[model samples]
Target: MASAITTLAADAPTLSAANTGFMLICSALVMLMTPGLAFFYGGMVRVKSSLNMLMMSFISLGIVTILWVLYGFSLAFGTDSGSLIGWNSDYVGLSGIGITELWDGYTIPVYVFAVFQLMFAVITPALISGALADRVKFGAWVLFTALWVTVVYFPVAHWVWGAGGWLFELGVIDFAGGTAVHINAGAAALGVILVIGKRVGFKKDPMRPHSLPLVMLGAGLLWFGWFGFNAGSWLGNDDGVGAVMFVNTQVATAAAMLAWLGYEKLRHGSFTTLGAASGAVAGLVAITPSGGAVSPLGAIAVGVIAGVLCAMAVGLKYKFGYDDSLDVIGVHLVGGVVGSLLVGLFATGGVQSDVAGLFYGGGLEQLGKQAIGVFAVLAYSLVASALLAFLLDKTIGMRVSEDDEVAGIDQVEHAETAYDFSGAGGGAASRSTAAPAPSAASKKVDA
Candidate 1:
């Protein structure tokens, strides 16, 4: 029966139903990460801006999904034009697609692949929302999300994953999105923050997170979804590789959280809930690129190093004077680089591909490739995001007015608050409304 099982799997058709179903479920798991991100980011900001932060991530779901079906997927995953881009427009609106037709190499249908990739496209831009929290114009951000993904994300994704992409040809190991998603968004966050400038009270304000529980909840969801994020990148559930990635993902995140708490105790004399949440995310980001390539021990090393490095890196914003509002640059970009580069150090031939890293005797060749991949995406995303942001700033404007920012972005941008504490605990509270602010006051004058 075991031999029969092996024979059956080996003989399975290219359009294997099992692989298709697995891909579809993984797609759902990947889809959950965006909202997970919304919650994660929402809880990090002041209470007044929490809803806007959530919307920053929520809006990407709508915008990127629509664009992906229309043309984004085609540009990112369609057949190659050369090394820089994928130019087939046939996938626009998914034309010529069949319900049962297998995608290029996998048993999953083309639509399944499209949807899976769609989730990645959605979250990549959402990742930047954290850096720009509390001060961006919603319209301008919406426009920027649309444009930045087009120019920076699609092409870079093509470079890393699409056939004939220079990076793919060069043998860069981005297993999932170390370069395309995390590092790309991280650098873009830095660029746009440079263009938008700092928050009004970045240095002086205490600016503590309004709800650590919410952040912890969100981080928990991300860790849950990442099982799909990393393992699903395999595009099938056929072998030990997926299981290895799953184990690595869990262990790395666990190790990172501990490392972060340890670092926090040493640095601040306490272990914080915020540190725990942030550390888990740092591990997720770090293992994303290198997980499939490294051993379980290597995963622990990656996690601990990432936890320590990212914990320290977050402080750079203050020293360097950039207001990375939610530490996107520090955590994602820094963690991504750590993971991608570590592939060169920890990759073993025992895993998915035959490639081995330094510890396993593969040398620095993979490391050099990883470096090239990182720099290329970083430079491109920075330039493109800055240009896009600068143009938006010059045209329809990007920053909210100083008054709106201080008063609260939730009210300024969305006219709703995240919480109505006024309604808490009683009868009179039932009639309570949002406390009047400038935007609300403007209504009185107009009336």
Candidate 2:
């Protein structure tokens, strides 16, 4: 370790062992959120399409990882390009990211930063898949993922976070990713849902989750991974801000879960596991931007408001006639907006950024800035995603055939099934129906 630091002496970048190590671990933690989301979304889907739901999320890690290394990172974080995007092509494929070169303010090597950011890039698109669940062709979906990131995510990331970016200059208080991650994906999900239309049965059939256990498990994993997701945005462990964020993340999630259960009991006369898990996620999303900025009390306030808003927002699909299968728009989009907007009201000075919010005597200026950031990203993402999905649907086709839809997407798309949701083994399969039995002659052969 000593020799490694000494070797880079000529660079004079002043590497910090603690920050470098913390960021790498944080990156890994963020990466886990994608698969965790798969289990979460998979559980929400019908058993027949559960595996396909899982695969939709899993594929993002594979596709986005490669793209980020190739040119995605360059276009995102490279030199300013008219304040709209980046253009230091030299950083493409990490070409100009020297071994000893440090990030602008931090001590970690730029490559470390790149890898960390790659995880964020990978997961953002995966968040969109749950809205389009069970109907998209895997190939078309893959193509959409690639194009959407290139067109929508990359440029918006530049606008929001890249050097000389407009939002950063305007002082948007994202803290983590209320705008760039949650709102962006949430609005994109809405746009695509408008284009794709509804699931086969829509309001007619009961689309209850196949596995509440998986939903709880996924929610548990998201709660765990979010520690890294929120605190790690500080870019180092040297500050107490990370500790504050850690506690805030926990408190807000707990508050939201409680609030959701209470709301469910009032509205439906019973608390539900699905409501608990979804509420926890809504809380996590709400705190992503505000946790670092708000007090623990503030976090609870944000949590309660987000819990109620998102809990109600999920019902919009029915009223407006959009088929957001797993409530990505409701939870992520609504939660993100709740968190971002509240930051302007809750952010007290003396925290990480030292920016006072409205309640702190900073007036409504900061809150207004937060609103601009939120709506700007929201509008751009919605338009771009709708156009992209519409084009894809028109050309190569987006939704599967009605035949494939009723039979199950896993069987139609992957030629595999999640499990015997049907009673295939004569054991009363899962929740749906019985799988077809083998021919009478080939019935286990008495083996």
Clash numbers, per candidate: 0, 4
**Whole-model lDDT values for every prediction:** 0.92, 0.91
Residue 440 Cα positional deviation in candidate 1, in Å, after optimal superposition: 26
Consecutive 10-residue window with the lowest summed lDDT within model 2:
422-431
Q: What is the TM-score of each candidate against the true structure?
A: 0.93, 0.92
For model 2 the local lDDT of residue 389 reads: 95
Summarize candidate 2's per-residue lDDT along 90-136 as a digit string, tens digits. Answer: 67888877897888877898888888888889889999999998799
At residue 35, candidate 2 shows an lDDT of: 91
Model 2 scores a C-alpha lDDT of 0.91
